[model samples]
Target: MNQRTFRTAAATGCALLVAAVGPACTGTAHAASPVGLATARVADAVRFPWLVGPVVVAHRGASRAAPENTLAAVDAAERQGFKWVENDVQQTRDGKLVVVHDGTLTRTTNVKRVFPQRAPWRVRDFTAAEIARLDAGSWFGKGFARERVPTLREFLRRMDEHDLRLLLEIKNPQLYPGIEARIVKELSAAGWLDRQHVRRRLVVQSFGANSVRTVHGLVPEVRTGFLGNPPLNALPSYARYVDQINPQLSKVDARYVAAVHRLRGAHGHRLDVFAWDVPLQNHLGIASTYGFDGVIV
Candidate 1:
């Protein structure tokens, strides 16, 4: 697979800054069956080497194959054997949580064609019904026109059905308050909020320390990741909450990973370091050489 080289620090910083500024489940009574494909079974089923290695995380599902943040793309990623699929979530004006990469639909949907007057509708400004009416897939290609933005609940249901795992990124912490609580409530409603055994399924990540801390408070057992530039000292406040610290591989080197490993809170659990968007091959080398936990690419 041809890999995209990491861009300069300036570009990465700009993207993350805008992203920081912007921006599932439920079940019937208990049964013998697991709510989200038994955690034990999932852990046992895919024993990702405790050893660090390139974890084939689908960047917004199988984004290269389909419009990102859609069920079709997620399914394609699962079918293709990606160990985990990642997605970004934002709150709609109606307070419904939806799977989307941006704070607005204009760039990915034919919103302009349909709502000519609302040429620049922000995702936060539109109600769920209005947002749903926008064509979310045709921009990717005509054949994908059937695709629609999915709700967190819908996405989790599908994930449970397919027995797929995820690396969810909380995109906008400031734009919407109580998102962490909402996320936990949604997962619990879908019957996945509480699990006995947890090491690596249903991971959540965010560049915002507040968001990461909120998720940690809501579901402490579930693993959480903090994404940012490194040296580890830059965000000392975050070191306490996240289970893992994820940074762009381009900014991190062997020494950087080592420094992150040394970070510790009053309790034990040293933060696992996960680098993002590395080409598949470089990912292997970093994991093997540095003893880092994984990469999200």
Candidate 2:
């Protein structure tokens, strides 16, 4: 794996200044805002030993460059020197876990042509074998026509081979009730729970708070995060079960980041704040200005 670069303080200051002043600033001298100063302080204080700084998480394995949730996408991200990749997982009709992002397959796959009778192609309606036959990448481009929707086991094996960290989101837990336990079982069966290195690299996250709590109870060793723009009053409660709080990028600011850090949970754990769907250019600057622990770009 290759080393990743973080944002420098000078760049962060410039970005924040630009953010504070509208793009139409006409060389007007402005006083430093309280939010800007606080953001810088929080950024300096929130450093972790295992991480260099705010981590760069490739959302959906660099979805902009390749088909989302396919092994080819992950391989592309690895080739680009990204250490952290995020993907979604859901159970098929036969209870087999597959890597996919949508409730239906109309968008990213050739499901309509392959399963012409299976309209509204929900993932739960198909068995794993049925899903494996669908071309997951051709919709993106002809160059990726051979890409397949990889299983959770295949995804993890690829991540391990590349020494990459995974941010695994359990997509639509309500669709597959008891999926939390199933995911834990799958992880254990794959020897992920037995290896210390693998355990450190794995993180389970979900938009459902209950699902996050369920995973925390089932596998306390793996770090978990909740994805949503949760209420400010709910931070303390979320900290009890999750190690990180991943809110929408637009919802994040210095005040929100500080509140998350202040949440003290079991074993004196402070919830790390990560923002999602952040754009590529000036990402570090935005992360620093908002005091994020990680940015899912």
| Candidate No. with top lDDT | 2
Cα miss at 49, model 2 (Å)?
20
Q: Could you give candidate 1's per-residue lDDT for residues 1-297 as a string of tens digits? A: 122223233234324433222110001111122322232122212212221234557678755445678887777666656667888988998888989888778877777787778746778887778777877767655656888888898888877777777888988778989888888888788877656214546888898887888888867777788888644556466666777788887777777787877776313578777777664324455565665677665
- lDDT for 102 in candidate 2 is 93
lDDT of 2 by residue, 131-201 (tens): 99999876766667799989999988888788888899999999999999999988887767776744568
Clashing pairs in 1: 23-172, 24-186, 25-189, 25-190, 26-189, 26-190
Residue-pair clashes per candidate, as listed? 6, 0
When summed lDDT is taken over every stretch of 10 residues in candidate 1, the lowest stretch is 22-31
Q: What Cα-based lDDT does every candidate model obtain?
A: 0.66, 0.76
TM-scores of the models, in the given order? Answer: 0.77, 0.82
**Clashes (candidate 2):** 0
